[model samples]
Target: MDTQFFLSMDPPTVTYQEKRAGVRNGKPFFYEDGDLKAARQKLKAHLSKHRPKKPYRGGVRLVVKWCFPRGKHRDGEYRITKPDTDNLQKLLKDCMTAVGFWTDDALVASEIVEKFWAERPGIFVRIEEL
Candidate 1:
């Protein structure tokens, strides 16, 4: 499949870039500590959900995608060239920063169903949420 179509399919909710690197979007983002900070913030909200009668005790998994404009960031790698493909590692890590906030966009991120990924790969940002 084409790269742009793949990345654009999701209409990324979280707007971010590598900590000190710029790419297709012509801007840099917080990637170095993005996962750590994102995970902490997400867990905070996850735990809050438990305060109420939330016996299920299930935390959601969020996926972060940073496909370069006109390119693809899949799996964990950025496909900058034509017919691009990668491991989406950065994307997943970035999503870690948005663990708890995933559901928050249910109303705004309309393509949530097609765009969301279930697991956090490469990085150990699992939110064994309480």
Candidate 2:
């Protein structure tokens, strides 16, 4: 099955790379930064409505277009700023997994991710079984 959806919100620039590490009782632990936590919650909340009834079990191709609010850049311009594409996808896929889009994000065998400046800020996602 194929699934596609658009989330209408400013795509958060915070990425999974924001996870912080600390030592507790001589043991190392990792935790999300406050901004990263907020970003994950926001993405999960938006992704919840589009969750599939059954998680995809086969390899899947995932496409994501992150559209940020247009500032000085023109609409549709490729965003070449902070937050690399891979980093952005990492956080998003984590949220997708948490929201049950798939049993595990490792099921994703292919990915195409892009970021852009846009008049209507939002995220566009397309998932196809492969």
Candidate 3:
């Protein structure tokens, strides 16, 4: 099975890597920063609307295209700035897991992630059974 969709909204730049660390009673703990928390919540809310009827149990290929609002960069140009791809993908996969797109994100045996500047910002996702 293959599922593809485009989410129309400004993609958040804050990523999961922005976690904060603190010591509590001589124990270290990690927590998401306020910006990261907000970003995750926003993504979860949007992603929940697109959950598949059944979670993918088998291996799957996941593709994500993150389109950001164009600033000085030309539309369709690759974004080579802050918020590295891995960090962005981590947060997105977490939200996908929460929304039950699949039993677990580990089912994603292949992934292709990209970022670009665009006049209409959004997230484009394609999932295919492998």
Candidate 4:
């Protein structure tokens, strides 16, 4: 089975971060950054409205196309800015998991992610069972 959707919102440039730990009551507590949490929540809420009826179980291929507004950059140009491609995928995949797009993100055996400058900004996602 294949699933595809487009989120018509300017994608966040923030990314998931490594766990941060602190000692509280002599106990180590791990936490995520507040910006990351907020970004994830926003993504989850956007995706929940269009989540598939059932999660994909088998190995899957995921493609994410990120379109950023053409500001100083020319249209169709690749975005070579902060929040690298891999970092962007981290948050997106986690959000996909939260919305039940698949049983686990590990099921995503292959991924194609790209970012480009565009007249309009949004995210296009495609998932196919493999």
Task: Give stretches of model 1 more than 4 Å off.
Answer: 1-17, 21-87, 101-130
Candidate 4 regions with alpha-carbon error over 4 angstroms: 18-20
Q: How do the residues 5-98 of candidate 4 rate in per-residue lDDT, one tens digit apiece?
A: 8888888888775546899999999888787777788899888987999999999999999998888888889988877999899889989998
lDDT of each: 0.32, 0.94, 0.93, 0.88
User: Cα deviation of 100 in candidate 3 (Å)?
Assistant: 0.3
Which residue pairs clash within candidate 4? none
TM-score of each: 0.19, 0.96, 0.97, 0.90
Clashes of each: 10, 0, 0, 0
Residues 1-130 of candidate 2 have per-residue lDDT tens digits of 8999999999998899988999999999999988999999999999999999899989999999999999999999999988899999999998999988998899999999989999999999999999
Candidate 3 per-residue lDDT, tens place, 1-130, comes to 7999988999999888889999999999999888988999999898988899999999999999999999888999999998899989999999999999999999999999999999999999999999
lDDT of 1 by residue, 14-128 (tens): 2233233445577654344565455445434433432323221234433333333332334434334322112233333334234432333222221111122222321112222
Give the winner by TM-score: 3 or 4: 3
Instruction: Work out how many backbone clashes candidate 1 has.
Output: 10
Quality of model 1 by C-alpha lDDT: 0.32
Candidates ranked by lDDT = 2, 3, 4, 1
Best by lDDT: 2
At residue 97, give the lDDT of candidate 3: 95
Worst 10 residues of 4 by lDDT: 12-21
TM-score, predicted candidate 2 vs. hidden true structure: 0.96
Question: What are the per-model C-alpha RMSD values against the true structure?
Answer: 14.3, 0.8, 0.8, 1.6
